[model samples]
Target chain A: MAGVAEFTKFPSESLKVGKGFKLAEVDPDTTPGYPGNKADGEALLEELDDKLAELQEKLFAESKFGGTKRVLLILQGMDTAGKGGIVKHVLGAMDPQGVQFKSFKAPTPEERAYDFLWRIEREVPGAGMLGVFDRSHYEDVLIHRVHRWADPKEIERRYKAINEFEARQVAVGTKVIKVMLHISNDEQKERLLARLDNPAKHWKYNTEDLKQRAFWDDYMAAYQAAFDATNTDHAPWYVVPASKKWYARIAVQQLLLEGLGEFDLEWPKAEFDVEAERRLVERS
Target chain B: MAGVAEFTKFPSESLKVGKGFKLAEVDPDTTPGYPGNKADGEALLEELDDKLAELQEKLFAESKFGGTKRVLLILQGMDTAGKGGIVKHVLGAMDPQGVQFKSFKAPTPEERAYDFLWRIEREVPGAGMLGVFDRSHYEDVLIHRVHRWADPKEIERRYKAINEFEARQVAVGTKVIKVMLHISNDEQKERLLARLDNPAKHWKYNTEDLKQRAFWDDYMAAYQAAFDATNTDHAPWYVVPASKKWYARIAVQQLLLEGLGEFDLEWPKAEFDVEAERRLVERS
Candidate 1:
């Protein structure tokens, strides 16, 4: 891990805090190489998709019976990371109505007036719904720390606030799963260049992004600190190796299924009015 | 329109205006149905999908080249009103990488502290990307109005604020398309009952939803007011008859294609170094 190209070098170890709290920090060595692992990634993604679809159906059925719960999955990553692609394939299997995807942005003047978690809570999915966040409140720590937008003491307070907030959500039965997609700067540059040269995607390029790219090391350091501090059992972080978009999506999908699998989704009893059906049939 | 049962009657001729504009009131008996009479709704939808797919490819190619102007389509409607189905079919034709879908929900403490549009601006698709809002900031009018969370004066102010917000987006070259999936209450009830009885949908059932169902009249009144206040030529509301989910999807697909047709998307000229390529190849 130490001698390999820094872009592909990742620490190979799991951070375990007692029994139920374990952080799977993906090792770059174990991570699949793109194109080389495309076949395996696609197959795994498809398989994960099938299971998600099946479980989602059951989850929906349970929702229809007057007892439904919502699922919120959050994705965090640096620019040029594979959050968009991850969402595309992971949700490829479920019915659209069962899902709601939301991508959080920088706080506006109005948002600035409120506490950090305020905007996030408003978008929580209702029962029987699914909400996906591309970047979430954790930005308070990651981006804020990197940009020096908040005091160190305040950032410290926010880490605990985020953990407690997530715990409260989990306590309320919301299956909260967070994923941090990690991609190397080389890959990021490659993808950004692709975006620059592709006409259909020409609209996505911005001059400002290049300036931000210069601070890659700073962002990574901040991310490492944020992930280390905020990752907890209630809303644990899964550091995904996203050099391969397909494999990243597969891993995230499987993680989601594993988390949601706790809910015994089943078809509830339907109270059909037999007499009303018969009367309607007679009238017709 | 006057005599139909609550929330279930199709106001085939309902006139809708958005933000500081007034449309001629729709009288179901007098207003003509589906004036774009070149083809059946379903056929038109297919054509729209084909065209949209073509345009999306061009758009993504531009995106790949470094353009960031993204498109955002907003869909708004009541429960069982086919928002989900429309999303599935209309967007089914686009490349997933170029598009992202979002659904707005009830405000959390964080969201409540900010203005309604704060969350929305973040969700806007970047250039070469497509963003879809299953339900959007218009909720300020629909739910906030009905619940009296905002005074009438504030509601009135929102009409202009929303209009200006969307127009500013259009000015910046974001293709904004809004679709109101309209369905009759009778149709909605049929669908809801079906969901209840269908074992696959039991998980989607919620007792609270039924409680909301009892206030159908209030919701429709709110819908009528919302469309009346916010519909504009820039982002005209396409009221698709959603009695048939397939047809609704197709209608939305067509509208998307039409909106995207304005872009002059093309591939960029690449500056490749032939000598470098040859030398690199020989070295390998």
Candidate 2:
């Protein structure tokens, strides 16, 4: 992914968690790409919400005008990584119909028996719709590697598989935006404890978060390896800080908006005679 | 079919095209139910557009809060009857993801071997969606009856089948809104000629529309008969005047708005800690 040209619309230096990336050196609390404070971010998001919504509609309406384009946004992070918050806040700004969201959980016996990518292939959005994966096959490399569920050799093979899979999707007109929400262990500990303190949040509290915290170093190493192996020019991975919740939310939304901004979609021309239809209306 | 109580929100006498109705006696240019002029009707529609859109979001979001609901909008009309116009102007105002539209054409050879209702059963929208049928199986009773493609005995049987089919849909939580756009013969001529004159509209000016125009009287008789036989309490029909283009467009929007208005939908409750999450944001 080195020697890549800069994106026409993605000019922000703060959010470019891309190639030559190393996980340990990056600060979890730094808003590297954001220019505004939380209040300014909130105001920016308020304006973006409508722009993103209208862009989605334009993307959808384009297919009727003989344009075939699709988008797949892959979101990967650890427990309480603000993945759900991104969906509820950043991606939720549009008509729910325009986007399809899936949170991939542990594989069933049937799923595991097949290739790991087999379960994900069919779920990609069809042309003209946006598909969001809250947790993706990156889990296979991240969790699977950290827990030693797969040997290093096998984990490396899956990384290559993911790279090839996304390249093929790009070849078929699907734009892939992969994001990893980076948060410090300290922030995660507070989030986990908050879930335990509140009865209403009991449903979100998973004891596995505590167990996984013990292997934090191994998980970080796994994420670094996965990023090096799979981050490609075709579908690059972006890491955004999650400690500042509102900043992370708006940054991710900006990433998606800038990505779609390159497409140059426009209002589809009416297929009928405008003057004639107007005359008909006027006569009536 | 006859004993059901009146619709709670459907109190307009102008929009009713029900059983025991005769086509010739009804004025094609009158707006009996509307309490406004053309400009006022246009303003009302502008208001209803946003109301209908929000209602659709509530309907789609309801199942997350433990409610299951679906809507099927069935539109039947003659050539240049403004069926497509209503879909483009009215249904187009909302998020397209929540609405599914199908313009049913002639049945394929594969579809012809099965019963008429078989093709339709599979197309009904699932829970939490709005399905719009630009043309529905009511064609079986209308054109099929008018052209004598089916014997009167079979036609009679199909009517009974339609009632059972719609009742099943209603029983399973799909609200069916049936509308017939009624336009005068003079208006039809003007529309057909307008299509002929405009090169841009040539694609829409079907030669079949000319063939069907010869059988206009028979088609009217077919429509009258179809209304009497199949206008059930579960899925009644509305005949909105289409001579005035804006009037018909707004009227159909009102009908669908009123149909979904009765649904008791609310914002789906968050399964997580609303209070704690708010606190977490505030702290951040």
Candidate 3:
């Protein structure tokens, strides 16, 4: 939040957090984007943020009042991996009116009664808009698998359900982009301790993170398993090394830009003739 | 992740994310910690991270193999508030063997069969361990209120339930720390758009964020209301301005340290005489 930073293209393949992708192989210190100083990178990020905002505005305008297709960004990461920074600096650029951000917390009593995707379905960005899931149905597989919350059979079933669900989204024109923000255990400790040392951040620290930290290996394996099971071309999972906050932030921004660009989104044509509208304005 | 940073004490009063709090009031860019460049801040963060790691180790050691009391830190915030950051940095420093982190995603079919807190109770940090809830039952009142998922009476009822739940935790020797990572609307935009620009980050961008962004005012009001309704002396809510990633990270770490400090946690006394045990081990 201090300032946006510029980012360069990210090596998505190197950072994928799933099968064939070992979390241990990624270095949190590596900056995949602009290899500039923090200040310059941040400044560039601000500039890029503005540019992205314009694109999102157009994307949203097209989707909503403009009659364009919609976009959905699914951010997945362990606790404190900077998914939030991406949201604040990248997605934040879009006009709030046109975007939909859902931070999926624990499901409620009613949500539990239905399939996991049911709630996700209710919140998918409609036509001509972009939708963001801070955490998504993927949790049903990731955390569930790590913790063995469900039997292997059930977990297997949900993975299939997820693939089918996403295929459905793509069919309906929801550009489903999934990114796993990958951070190292060392980096994770640094981030968590910052909060422990600062009183103002007390509310942000969860003792459970320490508890879950216990399962880092399990979670990593789980993520790898989930990615292997669900990383379809229609919804391929890109793993981003997240140890470097700036790199992760800008890399994600760039990723989003590319996704939207593929849509060939345009400012919706004016509702009326430009010449006539201009003449009326001139008269007024 | 690159380099850790040094941090100063944070202002808890100013950062409380609840009632009488204006999101705009706090500048996200403020680094109450070390006011140096990003590099220095990160360095100090790393130094603090190691120390906190040691402390958490002691805390956990006293509980698990050591036998100590329990700690719970609950984090609640709007999307992109950096809860994840605190989790990685501060809590990550702790021994993963003893930490239990539960990110409460949307409820599952089985979870919905009971009250909101049903699942929460099942996940509380056990004796001598640390438990973290990425998002707790607070969502029952938060998102529910913003979208009118529940009536006013129901919202009020849930608030009461949360207070009671925390009170019970206190009775059971659980140190419940609640935090809210607050960011300005402008900061949020920068983040969201960054996601849009980066194809790699498209997954992090949720169109739903924009829809939720549309209801910023409503969510803000709802947050303030919830804070008033549920924030208690025993489990008070601290709002940290997260625009400054370092400041927020350090603040939460400090808060957790203080919480753990109060416990007088010590390496649990050995069950048997150390010298005798050592002699037996030597014999073996």
Instruction: Name the candidate that leads on TM-score.
Output: 2
Please state how well chain A of candidate 3 matches the true chain A, as a TM-score: 0.90
Worst 10 residues of 1 chain A by lDDT: A3-12
- Candidate No. with top DockQ: 1
lDDT by residue for model 3 (B16-100), tens: 5555655446565776545567666556666766556556656655554535467888887777777766776666555444466
| Off by more than 4 A, model 3 | A1-19, A64-68, A281-284, B1-284
Count residue pairs with overlapping backbones in model 1. 67
DockQ score of each predicted structure, in the order shown: 0.15, 0.08, 0.03
Work out candidate 3's RMSD over C-alphas: 13.4
- Specify the poorest-scoring 10-residue window by lDDT in model 1 chain B: B4-13
lDDT of 2 by residue, B167-258 (tens): 99999898888888888887887887776566545545555666687788999999888888877777888887788877787778877777
What lDDT tens digits, residue by residue, belong to model 1 across residues A135-207?
A: 9898888778878899999999999898888887777668887777877777777776676555545454455
Which candidate, 1 or 3, has the higher lDDT? 3
- Write one digit per residue (lDDT tens) for candidate 1, span B163-259: 9999988887688877777666666667667765565654444445555666667777887777777777777775666666755655566566656
lDDT of 3 by residue, A107-189 (tens): 89999999899999998987767788899999998888888888999999999999999999899887788988888877777
What C-alpha lDDT, on a 0 to 100 scale, does residue A64 get in candidate 1? 54
RMSD of 1: 10.3
The local lDDT score (0 to 100) that residue A191 gets in candidate 2 is 85
